[model samples]
Target chain A: MVNKFSIKNLDMYYGDFQALINVNMEILDKEITALIGPSGCGKSTFLRTLNRMNDLIEGVRVEGEILLDGENIYKDIDVTKLRTRIGMVFQKPNPFPMSVYDNVAYGPRAHGIKKKAELDEIVEKSLRRAAIWDEVKDRIKKNALSLSGGQQQRICIARALAVDPEVLLMDEPTSALDPISTLKVEDLAEELKKDITIIIVTHNMQQAARISDKTAFFLNGELIEFDETDIIFSVPKDKRTEDYITGRFG
Target chain B: MKKKINFKEGLIYGIIGVATLFTIGILVFILGFIFSKGLPHLDSHFLTSQFDSTSAYVDVKLSEGTENPLGLILGEMTLKEKGSIEKQVIVVKDIEKTSLAESAVNNKGQNLAISKNDIINRIEGENVEGKSVDEVNQILNSINADKVTLRITKQGGGIFPMLMTTLMMIGLALLFSVPIGVLAAIYLVEYAKPGRFVNLVRFATESLAGIPSIIYGLFGMILFVMTLNFGYSLLAGALTLSIILLPVIIRQTEESLKAVPDSYREASFGLGANKIYTISRVIIPTAMPGIVVAIILSIGRIVGESAALLLTAGTAAKIPSSLFESGSTLTVKAYTLAKEEANIELASAIGSVIIIIILILNALSKLLSRKITKI
Candidate 1:
């Protein structure tokens, strides 16, 4: 299987604080890869470096290469164009205070798709893909912020999908959700991997085991182990990974 | 300790209540005073007519030879043919015939002219021309019956033109300020890297907000009116007022833009939106309430603006035919009436209108913001 993103010897720094150190990983295409770690373990930072989102923070620096489909993102890719191909869903859903249809259409609109019929089709298809079309179709003209938290999150997912990205990066996408919403999002991730690669950062080990095909465990700014999810859960590679999985210590 | 804390809280609450009452009391007092002074004088005709009682028409007839010679003032007596029974109100202008009266005595020394002041006050209400000798004396002898030499002047002096001028100045000032102020705020908040120069710019804006408006008026008079040769015009006043409004709008817009969460910007950028697109689409719409408040403040300043406009925009109480012509806003008109003419009742009437305008503007802002935000 081809890797969608291959990071080699990656290190990230915030001013004098080194947040990620000598990280190397290969994210396979069309599969759900989960990053699991305790608090302050640099899993979120590692995820951000893949899409160059850390570039927004002042005094932040990155070393080494992250290649998206064989091209170094730092050197060759335009940040805006790169983001379009690798859309992100944040930890807390951030929907623009616009209509539901507009929130879904925002990405395609940003990419210069102006025809109404085409945008309508894109919005419908994206909402369906996000598993929210039936719940919202009647009132797509209503403000997206008026919806429930779970629905808003789904709409945000639809928004990310509208741009037709090949890779979807989710940063603890269900951490803020209730149990039912979390399960729904887990089911969504499982269903979504057939079309596009998904990389998720989650604190719930059970969640990682249930939905992810591959799991990478991070400890103290370092990737301790990367393997099939079952093997990571059942078998042991390193002591810290074993400790983290069994809830012995993190 | 709990009892003591309760006493302190009660004391603070009492202070707050007193302060609120004081503010409300002042507002009620001013409104009551203005209404009492201005309500009786405020009527439709006073509000609708022009500032001056315009002279429309006068009855002048060429007088025959007389010893005083005040009546021989016209070269020709071509009466604008009207039916003897016709009665109509005509707009009277200048009623002078002295120049024509001089040329009437052509080479021969014959009294063929009527003097300019020999106005025949033809009473149109009754047939005084065909009156019997006794009846004519009775009409003249009676103090108020069949009066001759009617100088029928129309009721004049209205505040309508001043209201129009006030509206025009407000429109022009808002046009000049809003776009420039919003753009400047966007640049300062989003684009400019934080440093000493940016700090200096912010400091200058704050300082400008504190300077007295009279200073701004003087500066505007020197720069826009005299230096730029705009003269005492609505354009010059608006331009000056725009400068005064800039610091206010820029500060408000900047604060509103800053209030937009960083997460929104991140989301927009994460979705492939450029900086300009994110600011225009997401940020500005979210910050609209604060911007609207800024605009409302600017309007209040423009409407109540007297000191600045009096110097820059002259107090000519005519409906300006062009932007370059001078005009007076409501505050200026009231000020002129009160200070120069000492017409307190009329000034109070203008004051009442201004208060009503401010209320309408505030209500309009509320309606508009509610419509846009749906909140």
Candidate 2:
């Protein structure tokens, strides 16, 4: 398998407080990698670093190299181009207060796709890939907020997919959803990893074990273990990882 | 537990109900008084004519032998004249038989025998010679056995010019202020760094909103009317009004912009959209309903404003031929009519018109906000 992202000696700080420290890992292409940890353990922070989303926060300092396809994202790639290649779905279901069609088309429209037919094709295909086309096709012209929470989340997923990014970053995307909706999103993620590399930060350990091919256990701003999902769940090398998976401690 | 009477709640509810009723009662009473006093005077003629009263007169004489000769002549003239002669009246100065016969040759040089009927027919026919009422009165009074004057008077005319000027001022003021206010708000909310400078700017904006409008009027008079040399004109007035409206627009726009969810911005940025694009497409559209409400309220303020406009836009009482031309808005006209002319009826009529405009604007803002919310 080809490596999609290579992180070497990454350290991030928010002013005086260090959020991520000396983390190193390789994310494989076309695979679901899950990062599991307790709250405030820097899992979400590490996910934001992939696309430089942390740069939006004031006084954020980073010292490291995060290589995407052998190009240094911080030093070489423009932020806009970098973000275009790496799309993020926030924890909350945030569909823009517009029509579902417009919500799906927002990414393509931003990237300068002016042709209506092309946008129509992309919106439809993205919605289909997110497993929501059948439910929302009739009401595509309606405001996205008018839909139920699960439907809205799926529309958000479709919106992220519309940009056709190579990597998808999901930050606890199903935490706000019900059981059925969570399963739907997990299935969609499983299907999406066939074509796009996905890095998901999930609080639910079962969710991490179920969907991820590779799992990385993080605790207190440090990555304790990184291995295949089955090995991490069945026989973790580190005591902390084993304790966390077995619910002995976070 | 036994069911107990909630006397405290009842007392509070009664007090609230009375207060609400008191407020509504005052409004209804004021509106009722204004409409009753003003509606009768608000006719098509009052709406369409000028603002001055004028009267015209013509004089004539009568023979002595005829019974009620003055009344007969007026009745005959009314029947023969093409226009309404009801407004015109004939005043007989004298009645004498000898002088009438001697000056029997009418002003038209037509000979008339010494008969009352001939004189009446001549007066009713084209024998009267004079263009203006004053000239006719002079000639008829000069060669008189009996002299009469035909007088016609028209009361105060309409407020058409004032209405036009008010509309134009509103358009111009909005044109001047909306863009600057909205852009300033965008800068404050979206672009400015959270530091002392931005906080200072915010503090200054809030203080500006609290300052009295009369101070703004004096400032506008000095700045736009004198320094800029726009003079006492609609352009000057609009410029002044725009300054007065700026703080309101900025505050409201800033509030609405701040109300936009950060998630929208995040979504837009995640799609690789630039800040400008995201603001223009997502933020502005989301805040538009609030902005529109602000604009509508500004329009209401413009409609009711008198003191500021009076200093900048002189009370010319005519339609402004250009932006630089002096004119009076509805509020200014009302103020002038009540203060200078003491025409309370007309002033009340103008007040009612202003109230109607504000009510319509209020309704429009509500409708628009509801519509935009649905979208």
**By lDDT, who's the top model here?**
2
lDDT for each residue of candidate 1 in A137-185, tens digit (9 for 90 to 100): 9999999989988888899999999999999999999988999988888
**iRMSD for each candidate structure, in the order shown:** 1.5, 1.6
User: What TM-score would every model get versus the actual structure?
Assistant: 0.82, 0.81
Error of 2 at B181 (Å): 0.6
**B-chain TM-score, every candidate?**
0.70, 0.71
User: Model 1 off-target regions past 4 Å?
Assistant: A248-250, B1-21, B58-154, B363-375
lDDT of 2 by residue, A95-161 (tens): 9999999999998898889999999999999999999999999999999999988899999989999
Estimate the overall C-alpha local distance difference test score of candidate 1. Answer: 0.82
> Residue-wise lDDT of candidate 2 within B65-161, one digit each (tens)?
5644333222122222335344232322333543444233434455432322121222433344223345444444454456543333333357888
Task: Identify the runs in model 2 with alpha carbons over 4 angstroms from their true place.
Answer: B1-22, B44-156, B368-375
Residue pairs with colliding backbones in model 2 are B49-B158, B58-B150, B59-B148, B60-B148, B61-B146, B91-B148, B93-B147, B94-B146
Local distance difference test scores for all models: 0.82, 0.84
What tier of docking accuracy does candidate 1 attain? Answer: medium
Instruction: Categorize the docking of model 2.
Output: acceptable
DockQ of 2: 0.45
